[model samples]
Target: MVSHDPAPADPLSLHGVVPPTVTAFHDDESLDEETTAAHARFVVDRGVHGVFPLGTNGEFPLLSDDERDRVVEAVVDEVGGEVPVIAGVGAPSTHRTIARAEHAASVGADGIVVVTPYYYPLDGRAALDHYRAVADAVSLPLYIYHIPSKTGNELSLSTLSELAAIDAVAGVKDSSKNVPWLAQAIDGHPELTFLAGSDSLVFTGLEIGCSGAVSAVANAFPELVVDCYEAYADGDEERARELQSTMFEVRDAFKAGGAYMSGVKTALRLREFDAGPLRSPLRLKDEEATAELRDRLESIDDLEW
Candidate 1:
């Protein structure tokens, strides 16, 4: 088990809001490197702590391995040390996942976000071993991604504890909306950093000792999410709650349109980012729904950076 080291003297000890960027695509559905780099620069310039590409929000599963490598390279090059870049390396197979991790490291990513294996719902022991294998395979710090809803596997407390024992597994992006589980994970391991994976719970997670959040919504509204974290860290609980409530409203609006990913793309398009629609089977919202989302997002006067 890897133990959590103190915040590194180097810059990659990610705290505060790190936005999982949405992958932009051209009209023909090819990778839009220009728009993607602009989006990365836009988020970092907006005062986000870091930029995470190729996560679920980035529609990573739909991209080929070479495409993933190209996109990550583009982000790292564009960011150019202005902010840390944590590349997502969650392939369905452990071997491929490890390769992606190595690729991310080679491309100069500061860290990697690895999801639990999705195809076969591995038991606790298998899950533990999978993470251990990946951690051992890479020298870069790893943040385990626990989004059971998508992966169909959960990272139990014992699994987290075991992973925490490893020197390379620095933290987790706990996407399970279960508050009790989050509390137990945080309480059980004081050394590991717990980053909230869901945007709606960023403040609640922070209040309970989460180091930060990897928010999808931050791709559209970076300042709003950053404000929530800053408010809480400044000891202004009232301001934090207010900002969190506002975020919840935005999330609800997202749900009203569709799932958060589709809504996020819609919002970005509304903002003129040209982040193309979700891939097949993840259909875009209807025109009426999109207009409604635009109104809801636009109605919030302070959403801009």
Candidate 2:
């Protein structure tokens, strides 16, 4: 089994809230570097374990290669040594993924989270080879992003265990949100740390031996997340459960609106941050849903910023 302390250099391991930060954009749809870094600083100030840029919440696919690199740079520059900055370097092709990973290292990211290639399905061998190549391609700690709902490929148990054996592979951010499945992975492969990727499952994940969460809702309620994780770590199960339920409330409020990522950004804006808007193809236009989101959040007395 791998040590719980995955790496000596990075204190941000598997056991805390790491927000898949919303990418800040100008009204004209260009990247906003200042607002981007500011948001990172804001969350870090709330005591988040780490910051992840360019994941599903960050609008990774909509971003060009250059844009993604610049976003990582801005986030890394802001986060500094406060926490390990885990950048999502996954791309459709292995070549492009490696390029992004290399660029992430150049920009001083402490680690890289590589989601499975999307659009195309992969067999076990292909998936295993893809991760092996990515791990071999870079020296940085590689986190496997298993978000099968968005990415068509799902890493099978065997493939994941095999990939976990690779020394460079540090952990798996299981966004699938399958608690039983995640538990199996956690028990089956002790060498790899498994971070709960869903906001709703953060507490449950920690209960079942997960390191922590890479949450979308954490973008808005970072302190709630940090408190929940700390409560669990401190053995306050009652408080942990309460905060965990509150997290579910926040998650339900966000999901009630159709555009998932957009609702997250909207929540950020509601909190008075300049989180900007979603890019093309994905829009946040539901006034009713947005209002309902506000109502649900406001009802949570203990979930204050």
**TM-score of each predicted structure versus truth:** 0.94, 0.94
Candidate-wise lDDT, in order = 0.83, 0.84
Question: For model 1, which pairs clash?
Answer: 1-165, 1-166, 2-164, 2-165, 2-166, 2-167, 3-165, 3-166
**The best candidate in terms of TM-score:** 2
Query: Candidate 2's residue-wise lDDT over 1-305, tens digit each?
Result: 12223333223454588899878989888999889889899889998988999888889999999999999999999996888899999998999999999999988998899999989988888888888898888889989999899897888888888887888888889989777788888888766777889888877888777777898878888999899888888878889889889887887778776766777887887888966778887776478887888887899877895
Candidate 1 Cα misplacement greater than 4 A, ranges: 1-11
lDDT tens string, model 1, 1-305? 12222244323677889899878887678888778888998888888988889988888999989889988998999995887788999877889999999999998998988998897878888888888898898898888889899899988788788888878887888888999999888878777777888987888888777878899889988889989888887778888888888888788778775776788888777877777767777766789999899788777765662
Q: Candidate 1, 179: how far from true, in Å?
A: 0.9
